[model samples]
Target: MQNSDSDFFGRQGDEKILYVVRPHPLATTAALIKIYIISLAIFFVLVVLGSQIRVVSSIFYVGLQQIPEHLPGMR
Candidate 1:
């Protein structure tokens, strides 16, 4: 026979409500703002750096040089 006095999910005797820990509202807000500002600053820096650079890859050039013969200019 199932005990009617037992808590749901079968926990027995210690039927006390669990105390949940919660952070202060002001502190959480301040932390989120700080993170957002730091990320914005980093994003701007990367954008500025990307604008001042041109990326080139030599891999395609090397691959073209290695093409097999009897394929016209590859001879």
Candidate 2:
């Protein structure tokens, strides 16, 4: 015979509970500042790279400079 008072399952007292965590405000502010600095650094790098490409290409193609007759196929 199965007894109803035997309490074989469906126990509520043995369950575990979890809690949520929050970050400190100072820590959050510091992280944002760090990210901002990194972003600025990357932006500066891109700008410098773009300028260099422009300068080098302009210098390389600036011409009606005569090609040497010795160069192949220019006869």
Candidate 3:
């Protein structure tokens, strides 16, 4: 069956289209704002965690050097 402009996705002749579901503009805007805020918070948290990891790794490496090796040809 051929589809008409008013018909969607090969709808039958006896089928009636229901009201289209859509988010309201304000709801869309609020959802976008919420997503943006959550993204920013995650980004900041990752940045802080990354820096802390780097600091901890550096301290670990420095501490490693302070320990003397007991192996034969290793100073």
Candidate 4:
């Protein structure tokens, strides 16, 4: 027998559900834009740092060449 006191999902007759809260579309869009800008800034900073490190390493390696190749472990 189907029970009138309960619906198909099992909620009682007295139960009432409140409306779901959500952010406005414009607010959500602004948040996404902020995240994208911050991500781009971090990416550019890393690229610049990587290039700087390569340059410094090359300069240091050139300075090491003054030592004779016959020294132990030197190639």
Candidate 3 residue lDDT tens string, 1-75: 555556778676788877766688999899999999999999999999887763334653666765356633333
Q: Rank the candidates by lDDT, best first.
A: 3, 1, 4, 2
Task: Give the per-residue lDDT digits (tens) of candidate 2, residues 17-60.
Answer: 34335698999999999999999999999999887763323433
Minimal lDDT window, size 10, model 1: 1-10
Quote each prediction's TM-score: 0.46, 0.45, 0.49, 0.47
Any runs in candidate 2 off by more than 4 Å, and if so which? 1-21, 55-75
Assess the local accuracy of residue 69 in candidate 2 as a C-alpha lDDT between 0 and 100: 67
Structural RMSD, model 2: 13.0
- Give the Cα error of residue 4 in candidate 3, in Å: 7.4
Tens-digit lDDT track of model 4 for 1-75 = 453433335656777645545689999899999999999999999999887763334644777756466654433
Better of 1 and 4 by lDDT: 1
Which regions of candidate 1 fall more than 4 Å away from where they truly are? Answer: 1-23, 59-75
- Tens-digit lDDT string for candidate 1 (26-57): 99999999999999999999999998875545
Given candidate 1, what's the lDDT at residue 58? 77
How many clashing residue pairs, candidate 4?
Answer: 0
lDDT (0 to 1) per candidate = 0.70, 0.65, 0.72, 0.69
